[model samples]
Target: MKIKDRVIELLSDKYCGLLPIKSIHEEDTIIDIGFDSLRFMEFVVLIEEEYHIEFPDDLLDIQSTTTVREVIERLEKEV
Candidate 1:
């Protein structure tokens, strides 16, 4: 499965509402999602489990500048 698909699956399971996947896939940040702290934590859990790698602390500091592609890039780097 693709990265987007895995993300969508986790979102569905976690009921994370609608992620701005299209915008993120286009190299745009997911700023429109308005994901709060709780949701962002869930996203981090999903990323960790899906990629099987602990995310660096810096990812938590990236605010509206982080995109799905960028996240995937980070995961690939660790994997």
Candidate 2:
């Protein structure tokens, strides 16, 4: 699966009332997926678990991430 799609699945599997898949991808903002602080941290944890890597606290700046691709790229670099 595309990393973006996988990210969505990882999130949707954990929560309800997700935006339509099409709508989620129509924009570049991953946070537009209706994620708050708690869910944002959860996404970080999921990325670490899914990729078998760790996201160091100092490396993660949630404010700068706007899309799943951005998130995956950062995590991929870390992994």
Instruction: Using lDDT, give the best candidate's number.
Output: 2
TM-score, structure 2 vs. true: 0.62
Cα lDDT tens digits for candidate 1, 1-79: 8765666455443456365434334364645455555676877877787678787788776577777567667755676
**Can you tell me which runs of candidate 1 are displaced by over 4 Å?**
8-15, 20-24
Where does candidate 2 have its weakest 10-residue lDDT segment?
A: 13-22
TM-scores, one per candidate: 0.64, 0.62
Angstrom error of the Cα, residue 67, model 2: value is: 2.6
Candidate number of the best TM-score: 1
Question: lDDT of all predictions, in order shown?
Answer: 0.61, 0.62
Error of 1 at 33 (Å): 2.7
